[model samples]
Target: MVSRELIARHCICCGGGNLEKSPAVLMPFVALRVFGHEPVEITEDWGLRDLRQGMAYTLCNSLQCQNCGALFLDYRFTDEQMEALYRNYRDELYNEQRIRFEPGYANVPPHYHQRANYLCEVEAWLAPYLPEAPAVLDFGGDSGINSLFREHNQLLHIHDISGVELVPGAERADLERIRQCHYDLVTCSQVLEHVPYPLDFVKQMLPALGTGSLIYVEVPHEALLRAHPGSLQLATCKRHWHEHVNFFTESSMRVLLESLGLVVVDVLHLPVDIGWTQGEVMGLLARQA
Candidate 1:
């Protein structure tokens, strides 16, 4: 059974109509043999790799959300299925065997490092007005990287669901315990879109902050919608379907945050120069009052 939150409803982007729901199913793929000359056990669960398999690849027929215009993988995972899938993720595909990244390429930036920079940028911008040594918390502080707070020379206590595997000596945290603590600022970057219930996530995190505290959320700006329909380079990702279900535009983001009684303090457009993925529009949000 699909989790209620993952149930397909309205399109998040254009809000055209109801999304056509489908069942989640798996197919088999040989990643290396099909894409390159190596052996990577690709599975239908991986989505895009199997859909756009190769030169003679056949695209997977999944439902596109009418509102958000996102072609998403069906998210009907039963609790047992989701548990089994993620329970061994690190020990399995990501860690057991070091998958060779394609050669002649720069080491792609780690997701945590990129996220840390975003926190720093927000703090740098908000520091002038905030009191010195203000308390801050990152909702998904992967490795305490954001807590280092380099730009303002301040430290932020973090609360996360898990500890950092890559960074040694990082503190382990539970979301519930962190909520009991007070903070002046809260930052949750690039995490809102992956969640099935963004509104509730924000609602829960908001109370962890004190009065006049700020909350910063960053997510993709529906850049795919802005592309000319006929442009050949318009971005498309099959693998991404499983990960990012909610796509937000500037307007939609404002609507969602503001509806939760958080004032839209500011929106920052992320630099487009770093383009390993689609959509250049990333937003930085601050909650007011």
Candidate 2:
């Protein structure tokens, strides 16, 4: 396999050069299970030729920004690698490979097909802020199956890199089309954690925001980071990097949006029980400043 370079230099949230780095290990199974690359291939490609005895994973680093307290994996996957990682995303074949490495993964895919219970709470919370029958776009939202207001929206559009078939009433749109169209609400749910450059990813969506447009960004309120709020020592504890690379603090989320000239409407911590797992989500609501 070709070499995959680590591209993260500065903090993705605040763009800070001053970062704290700590040794971390990325399990070899992630290569085969998630990206379809073999363990030995990526280990060699990543230049960890000297795999110590009993070590079957790639040695990497976890970085935390001193400026904004954002924690993420040091590796920033390239576009090609990102494509490979999420190509089949949560589909049957993807689940099979993952289940080969982690048996527990088998229980997760069925939940993906169901309409997320969190969307009900999210829609209700957003109701007072949104207009009646708003035109909505779900960025990186696969199939628009769990998109808020899917049933009530005047127009519902889904922009996803994954080529999954959309559910009824949802139209597939390209990024350029999304930029040209004026959407009242743009929802990017459970996407930031997987992205290598969260800041740049959100910046790309700026053109889609009209004056009254509201952008909703949601990420897992990672337990480890939440347990030790504002602590730089998080890097030492985060030994393994998986699909969810960036773990955002509430302050870091604010900095990310505010830096983009967005007026922060509200930041919420919602408890979610998605059948498979119960966790908290850090949901941020923002509009054009």
Candidate 3:
């Protein structure tokens, strides 16, 4: 295996020039897997490609703006390719095997509890500033399960790329539609990192907010990377290009949001899994100043 350190040194996001064999960081490569050997389609931006697994091939980790500290492995996908991966790809990394639902009772597993805990933390932090059971928009709310917990007082609006029928208020609206409306609170949990452009994504939502409206966002904290070295491998396995492209630290996240004129009200750390690492998991609540 090639050295990750060497890859980092030549990382395009870190490196000064076009992709070259200068350092591993500036230009790194990792073992990648694709399901069913699907069609490798090219994206309009030409930054990504859908690599059909005709044969496993090594490719550059792609260049990112080191100044902004964005490291994306320049891989694009056609809509069909994306659908195939999300629907059919079943592996330890992409395990759809463990169903989180069963029947009448809430299939509330440990993960659900984790989600509940995170939501509770947010509730506490925003309690003094927010109104009782305010309307909330959960960007990328996969199933709207979290909305169930807040059903009593909070009115929930869910937006996601794929329309999930599982949740109650599941909206098939795209991000564009989401940007047009204002809500009392917005919950963007663990979704921003997967976006191709984090800055642009947040900016789109700014016009929709009132002065005191709150935006609650979460991403896999960069500290988690340091806490669990093995996560590097796990990340690659569990849909690297599609799932997450931009990683963030608390400082980075603050800078990104504040630049858009949102005042950072509160920031907290959260773990990906409580059992695995003692890393900092980050949550940020911002409001228009």
Candidate 4:
């Protein structure tokens, strides 16, 4: 692709404009899988629509927040781009089997852990805080399986753009209702990175949370990945530019939460899998002061 100066994005953490490009770059999504920077050559006729051969169509450049140490993809997708990409994201990259498996590992599906290990920490820390028959809202909680692990008797509602949530008895609430309803706990896991304006999105939902309510957040750690390069081959072998747009560091995440007038209760750096020498994702639990 044509090399240009990486756009300086407003830091969600520090509210700074010092985001700069990183040394690491990977292949574009259409050109390859999440394995490396090289093209994987997809010729399986999975509706090969737009084929362009150049740097502009190939490289997925990474950006770093010079002020906060967080890493993110500098490339921002437009409304049209987001629609075209997500329309077939799960179907192509995952469902149709476009993803590549690493050495010695079977081709395991994504969201390999129905109940993420990090959630265990969140679940434990949340026990003392939850009310009797807690009303839980899992924003972007895919399939609502994670809620099953939290509390059985709890009133659970799942909010997701994808309509594939298969949990029994779980209510599907829209943004309007969720914004008005007061929830005991609001979980936003792996959601911020996909949205164009994460700050504005949170601003919209903040009113739905009542006093003493908990907001549990999880995101991939860019700081850990930068420090541990070898672990990346397993975590993100190829670049996923469309989805994981923003990667947060521990310090950056704390600043982001605190900036929104929420007190940080705890921050946990969790491995991708328990006891494995690999990449990490971060979990943050916070509530209004």
Residue 174 local lDDT, model 2: 92
lDDT of 4 by residue, 1-289 (tens): 1122234355545667665544335334533343224445555464557864333335555666566655666555555555655654556444443344232223444554455556666566566767656788888777787762345546788887778745776888888888777888888877787765566556555776787788888776654455754331222332445456776666767777777888888776766663333557677888998
Encode model 1's per-residue lDDT on 249-269: one tens digit a residue: 566566667666778877777
Candidate 3, number of clashes: 22
TM-score of each: 0.62, 0.90, 0.60, 0.73
Worst 10 residues of 3 by lDDT: 21-30
Instruction: Candidate 4: list runs displaced more than 4 Å.
Output: 1-8, 23-26, 30-57, 92-94, 100-106, 110-113, 148-153, 226-242, 272-279
* Top lDDT model: 2
lDDT tens per residue, model 3, 245-266: 5566455577778777789988
Tell me the alpha-carbon RMSD of every candidate.
Answer: 7.6, 4.6, 10.3, 7.3
Best of the candidates, TM-score: 2
lDDT of each: 0.51, 0.83, 0.53, 0.62
Error of 4 at 120 (Å): 3.3
Q: Backbone clashes in each candidate structure, one number apiece?
A: 8, 0, 22, 6
Candidate 2's C-alpha runs over 4 A off are 1-5, 33-52
- Quote the positional error of residue 224 for candidate 4 in Å: 3.9
